[model samples]
Target: MGALADNRRFWLACNLVTLVLHAFGVYLYASEGFAHPVAQLWAIVLMLHMLEFPLAFIAVRERRIGWGVTIMATLIFGFTWWVPTRRGVFHA
Candidate 1:
């Protein structure tokens, strides 16, 4: 793999970490009701991710991807998942 591929992998790994953190944050909020500051931070991040959802929806639609998977992936990975996907990097 070249530099570009390595860069993409790095971003993908970051995305994975982001996903895990968000999930854990949500779990904390659900279980503890914002007792932790992380849970409060998660709410803000979720809102930001919600804003990214429409862009992800359009990108996935342009690629003729299914709505269900697109929704889940976009909610989880946001720009890191959709940008390269739109550029045909994953297919390449």
Candidate 2:
């Protein structure tokens, strides 16, 4: 149906935007060499990048709870993993 097509387009657009942001974050991190202050933030962004695929899969399958949990896990992972690395608690 038309509505389904429209929804798909919307999701596609969202995914594109997310990818762009992730790519930009990567550029910033790589070019700057992942120093303090920005490293952790970049790490979180990277983790978010990793979560996109699984989240999209759940979304496309219409699994609401799965999508929610995936999103939450992404956030947790990003903060825990990325933030610490930025603070120099971990390397790579």
Candidate 3:
């Protein structure tokens, strides 16, 4: 993804992968027993990854959801919300 645009939707789209990964992680956690070291580690990563939601929210409010955030979110959880970013909803 290019950086010269505020591709909020793209960011959100990318976030969908995170959902799938999280779901699978949850299943593994349950199947392996909640206290399993791998499960615990996945849970911790998920918890920390969740912080991106608020950060994305802030970016939306600022109208600055750049490609960096978008790609990161895409690589991560995908976006959890929509924003009228210049290169996204309001793109010319």
Q: Each prediction's TM-score against the native?
A: 0.74, 0.38, 0.44
RMSD of 1: 3.3
What's the best-to-worst order under TM-score? Answer: 1, 3, 2
Candidate 2 residue lDDT tens string, 4-76: 3345445445455545655666777777756744555657666665766454443434323355544554453
- Candidate 2, TM-score vs. the true structure? 0.38
Candidate 3 CA-lDDT value: 0.55
What lDDT score is found at residue 46 in candidate 2? 63
Best by TM-score: 1
Question: Where in model 2 is the C-alpha error above 4 Å?
Answer: 1-6, 35-42, 48-92
58 in model 1: Cα distance from truth in Å?
A: 2.4
lDDT of each: 0.75, 0.49, 0.55
Error of 1 at 4 (Å): 5.1
- Measured with C-alpha atoms, the lDDT of residue 29 in candidate 1 is 91
What TM-score does candidate 3 reach? 0.44
- Locate the minimum summed-lDDT window of 10 residues in model 1: 1-10
| Model 1 lDDT, full chain set | 0.75
Instruction: Give the alpha carbon lDDT tens digit for every residue of 1-92 in model 3.
Output: 36523566555564565566667778888788676766676677666656556555565655656656654552354333333342355431
Error at 38, model 3, angstroms: 5.6
